[model samples]
Each structure stands twice: as C-alpha cells, then as structure tokens.
Target: MVPALDSWQFWAVLSAVFAALTAIFAKVGLENVNSDFATLIRTVVILLVLGAIVAATGQAQALGSISGRTYAFLVLSGLATGASWLCYFRALKLGNAAQVAPVDKLSVVLVAVFGAVFLGERLGPANWLGVALIAVGAVLVAQRM
Candidate 1:
C-alpha cells in the first residue's frame, strides 16, 4: 500500500523525482536556447501554473492575512529560489546534468547544517550520517569523467 500523501517524506520523494526530471528536461531544452531566457520561460510557466492553483482554490483571498514575518521570509525564499534557478540553469547549460544535479544536491547538506544552527532543529547521528553520505555521493557523482 502507498504511504499517506500527507507525510513530508512522501512529498520529499515526489519532489526528488520531479527534480531529477527537471535536470533531464532542462538539459534537453538548454541545448537550443539561452539559459537565462529559458529560466524566464520556465519561471513564467511555473507562475502561471501556481497562480491558477491559488485562484482555483481561493487561496489568493488569504494573501492579506499573511503575517509580516511570514511574508518577509517567503519573499526571501523566493529570491533565493530565483537565484538558485539562475545559477542552476547556467550550470546545466555548461555541464552534464548528472554532474550538475548531484553538486546541486549539496544544498541538502547545507540545509541540514543551517537548520541545526538557524532553525534550532535537532539532528541526531542518523541525520548526520545521511548528510555525510550525501556529501560523499555528490563528490563521487560530480567527479570528472
């Protein structure tokens, strides 16, 4: 039986699947277009899709109720996402997606560390082990071949 969809792990795995596809698709698309222009197109598509969802669900109506702190952090997150996309696309344009994607996954390691320090999230031995494996695997995948 499938796990409940509400679980974060399930969602994270789904995200990983899509992220892997994103690299493959972006690599294919980048072959013919300027990476920056491609990024703009992708961003526009995402905005349209998500805007439609928000509108359809009446979620947009709640926008005014968002707290200032939440809004600030979300804005910051959006900026960070944009910057990451820009850099990721540029890197994908120049290198193999397989190599680039693993290197990008290093962000997972950074997140673990940052979450501990900034978010006060506790990371036990298993979490640290997983982080280490990710770091080593990223290096292995990103090696010159």
Candidate 2:
C-alpha cells in the first residue's frame, strides 16, 4: 500500500511552487492591474477555491472541531494576510524585485518573533541567529535601495 504524504510536506512543496509563480506573476500582472486590487482578487479567488474544497470534502465536522477562540484567531489571521498581501503587491509594483522580495520575506522573521512572544512558541539560539541574519539582510536590502 502506498503511504500518504504528510500534510506539512505537501503544503511545503505546494507553497514553494506557488511562491515562485506568485513572484513572477505578480511582477507581470501588476503592470496591468492595480496592486492592491490584484491582491484582493487573488485572495478572494483563493478563499473561494479553498472554501469550496472544504465544503465538497464534507469537512464541516473538522471545522466544527475548532473552538470560538480558534475561529477568531483564524479570522484575524486572514485579515492580517490580506493587509500584508496588499502591501507586498504594492511594493512589487513600485519597487525592484530584488529589494521588494527580500523586504517582503522579512515577514518570516516578524512572524517568528511574534509567535515566540505571543503564541508561546520557543525560539532557540540557532533560530535567534537565523532571525538576526534575516533582519540584517532585510535592513541591507532596504538601505541599498
């Protein structure tokens, strides 16, 4: 019998491909569309597609397992995602890819620090070092622009 791939592994692969396509497409597409509008359209399409999948898969029970607090957190996450995407797409439209990409990627470090501070997630020494490097790189990219 074939084994199923882990969910994180599947998403990791999918996200890598999607991220590459997003960068390329955002660069090209923004030439024609307003960047903030483009981000909204993309997010709306994504939510619709994923929502339909959840409905079609009879996953309402899975969603029901989430508590009110978790639901609130998820909604808040979606809101923040929308805001961030709008900013990133605007940057991509107005700035060079080299600088915009690195500065946008700094969200990784921001999220890690937020998780450690608010979500009770622990960042070990190595993770701290990585975050430091990311910060330095982001600062250099922005400064050089």
Candidate 3:
C-alpha cells in the first residue's frame, strides 16, 4: 500500500480541509479589515511560510536555473492567483462564506475545461458527467433560500 504521506489523494484531501478552514477564518478576519488588505496580509503570510519551508527542506533553487518559459508561466499564474484571492475576499466580505466558497469552487469546473483545451487533457464521459454535476452542485449550494 502507498504511504498516506506520499499519496496525491491524501494531499488533495488535506488541501480541501485547509481551504475550507481558510474560508471560515478569512470570513472572520475580514470582519473589520478591507478585503484587499486582508488578502495582502494572507499573501505575505503564505510567502513567509513557504519560504521557510523551502529553506528548511533545502529546496531553494537559483533563479538562473529556471527557464524563461517557466518564469513567464509562473508570473501569469501568480497574477491569476492574486486576482482570484482578491475576488474571493471581496465576495466573502459581501456574502456568506458558505455561499462564496461554493461559487469559488466553480474553479474546478473551469480547470477541467481549461485543461482539456490548453493542456490536451482528456476526460471520459463519466468524468464529464461528474464535472457537470459539480457545476450544478456549486450553483445549488450558492443559492440563498
């Protein structure tokens, strides 16, 4: 059996747990702070923690060793992440965390579509059905009664 620590499914589940906690914590944290400022603070904390982890793990690499294409893609991804955080924070500030988080999770659907189109990833019919169900579920969860 694969070790739980080394399993992608295990990490993904942890990520989801942490993400859920982030929404709840962020909602509380945003009570008095500006959403953009809250996001900035969160980003700084993330950078510091990740930097420490990389240093402790000896995973730091020389910037020159990375390819220009990699740098470009990483920059684009950073910008996208910043934009997403800003939008998510704003939504959380204006809406219930329960509602905001489900709508934000629509990113999973987008990722599947974008992966297929841009990364040449393929999904079978069952996978597509699951994606469709996720979209519907997100919409349903985000609805206010």
Candidate 4:
C-alpha cells in the first residue's frame, strides 16, 4: 500500500481542510479589517511560511535555473491567485462564508472544463457527470434560502 504521506489524496484532503479553515478564519478576521488589506496580510504570511519550508527542506533553487516560460506562467498564476483571493475575500466580507465558499468551489467545474479544452485532458462521461453535478450543487448550496 502507498504511504499516506506520499498519496495525492492525502494532500488534497489536507488542502480542503486548510481551505475550509481559511474561509472561516478569514470571515472572522475580516470583521473589522478591509478585505484587500486582510488578503495582503494573508499573502505575506503564506510567503513567509512557504519560504521557511523551502529553506528547511533545501528545496530553494537559483532563479537563473528556471526557464523564462516557467517564470511567465508562474507570474500569470500569481496574478490569477491574487485576483481570486481579492474576489473571494470581498465575497466573504459581504456574504455568508457558507454561501461564498460553495460559489467559489465552482472553480472545480471550471478547472475540469478548462483542462479538457486548454490542456487536452480527457474525462469520461462519468467524470463529466460529476462536474455537472458539482456545478449544480454549488449553485444550489449558494442559494439564499
């Protein structure tokens, strides 16, 4: 059997747990602070923690070793992440965390589709069904009843 530490599923679950905590914590944290400023603080904390982890693990690499293409893509991804965090924080500030999180999770559906169209990733009918269900579920859960 594969060790849990080496399993993608294990890490994914941990990511989900952390993400859920992020929403709850950010909701509480945003009570008095501006959402954009809160996001900036969160980003700084993430940078510091990740930098320490990389240093401790001896995973730091020379910047010159990375390809320009890689740098471009990473820059784009960083911009996207910043935009997503800004939007998510704003949503959390103005809406219930429960509702905001579900709507934000609609990104899963988008990723599946975008992967197929942009990355030539293939998904079978069952996977497509799951994506559709996720979209529906997100919308349903986000409804203000």
Candidate 5:
C-alpha cells in the first residue's frame, strides 16, 4: 500500500485538486444546467456546512455579534460571489479553463481600480508594476485561445 499523506498535507493537496476540479466540473455542468440554479445549489451547500460548523462549535451567539455593516458587506460579497460563479461557470462552458482562469484573474486589476476609486486607496509603484505584469499575463493567456 502507498504511504498516507499527513492530514495537513492531505488537506492542501485535496483543496488544490478540488479547486481545479471545480473549474473543470463547473464548466462542464454549466453546459447543460442553469447557472442560476447551480449557484443556488452551491449556496445551499455552503450554508449547510457553515450552519453545521456553528452548531458543532457552539458559536450560535456569534451571529448576534455581527454588526449591520458586517451583514451588509456579507450580503454584498455573497451577491458578487454568486454573480462571479455564474459568469465563471458560463465561461468555462464556452472556453478552456487554462484560458478562463487567467482572464478571471483580471479581477485583480479591477479590484485595484475599485480600491482607488471607491475606497480612496492607492497602490505603490511596485504594485502598479505588478498590475501591469498581471495584465500582460492575462492578455497572453487569453490570446493563446
């Protein structure tokens, strides 16, 4: 028999493999399934897991500690995440993951722009250079397809 990996090692490897599979499977599944329905199912599964964890950990009161601003952020994040999932899955259906992933990473540039415009944030010169590199990488990957 093969040697078993350490639990942490197993988790790391499993998570990476699962993440790649998520893109691949989501791409394939979205070909036939409705993206919105798939997102609903995905959200339900996430909520079930989180609820179970809270119940098991006895952190039920943690819910009361959540502030209104935190709740608003969570709701906005969830909506954005769901929208991203829909787009990613739909893109996967249309194109290769190799191509889709790098293009998806363009969100980094968008995030930086958002931070600058909305959050009154600024990136250093090195960060601006990094953004340029990211854009070039994404462009090359996308153009390859």
Candidate 6:
C-alpha cells in the first residue's frame, strides 16, 4: 500500500529529496557566481513561487489575519533561513557538497534539542537516540569525503 500524502514521513521524504536537489543545483550554480548573489536570486525565485502559491490558493487574504507574534516569529525564521542559505552556499563554493551537506544537517540535532527545550516537545529515548545517531553520522560523513 502506498503511504498517504498527508503523512509526516511522506512529507519528510519529499523534503529530503528536494534538499538533495538543492545542494546539487546550488553547487553547480555557484561555480560562476558570488554566493550572496546566488542566494538573492534563489530567494527571489522562492518569493515568486510562494507568492503565486498563496494567491492561487486564495490564502493571500489570510495574511492580514495572522497575529503580530506570528509575524515576528515568521520574520525571524525568514532571517534565519536567509543566513543559513548564505552560509550553505558559501560552504558549497568552498568545500565538497558531500561534506558540506551532511555537516549542514547537524541542524537536525539542534532542532531536536531546541524543540524539546523551547517548544516543550518531549522526546523519548528512541527519538534522542535517533538524534545522537544523526549527529554521529553527520560527523562521519564530514570526514575527508
């Protein structure tokens, strides 16, 4: 049986696929451009695509209904995303995508910890173990690959 599209695992796998493509595409694109400019172009594309999505879905009007706190958090998240993209592109420009991508994935472990601490999303032993394994795997993947 096929997994449901709404399942979190399904979405997670989709996200991973796109992320892999992102690394490959960004690496190739960075060869002849400044990382900052590359990031700007990418961000503009994202804005256009997401804007179109929002408009097509009739969610454009929902923006006004969002709370100020939500706006603050989203803006902060956007800034973090921009910073991450800049650093990631710079790293891809300087290092192997194989090495840089895995190291960049260290954010998974950080996310788990932050979620538990800040969001009170408790993780069981299995989840913590998974996070540990990801951290170790990231280190291993970063080694002279």
Selected candidate, larger lDDT, 1 vs 3:
3
* Reference-based lDDT, residue 17, model 5: 85
Q: Spell out the clash pairs found in candidate 3.
A: none
> In the order shown, what is each candidate's alpha-carbon RMSD?
1.7, 2.7, 1.3, 1.3, 5.6, 1.9
Candidate 1 regions exceeding 4 Å error are 1-3
Which runs in model 6 stand beyond 4 Å of their true positions?
A: 1-3
Tens digit per residue, CA lDDT, model 1, 1-145: 5666768998898999999999999999999999999999999999999999998988775667889999999999999999999999999999999899999999999999999999999999998999999999999999998
Minimum summed lDDT over a 10-residue window in model 1 is located at 1-10
- State the RMSD for candidate 6: 1.9
Angstrom error of the Cα, residue 8, model 3: value is 0.9
Cα TM-score per model: 0.94, 0.80, 0.97, 0.97, 0.72, 0.94
Please give, for residues 45-74, the per-residue lDDT of candidate 3 as tens digits.
999999999999999999999999999999
Prediction 1 global C-alpha lDDT: 0.96
Candidate 4, residues 1-145, lDDT tens digits: the string is 6699899999999999999999999999999999999999999999999999999999999999999999999999999999999999999999999999999999999999999999999999999999999999999999996
Q: What is the number of backbone collisions in each predicted candidate, taken in the order shown?
A: 0, 0, 0, 0, 0, 0
The better candidate by TM-score, 1 or 2, is: 1
Superposition error at 60 for model 3 (Å):
0.4
| Residue 43's lDDT in candidate 2 | 86
TM-score order of candidates, top first: 4, 3, 1, 6, 2, 5
Q: After superposition, which runs of candidate 5 have C-alpha atoms over 4 Å from their true positions?
A: 1-19
Task: For candidate 6, give the lDDT.
Answer: 0.94
Q: Model 6, 11-105: lDDT tens per residue?
A: 89999999999999999999999999999999999999998998898876556799999999999998999999999999999999999999999
Tell me the TM-score of model 3: 0.97
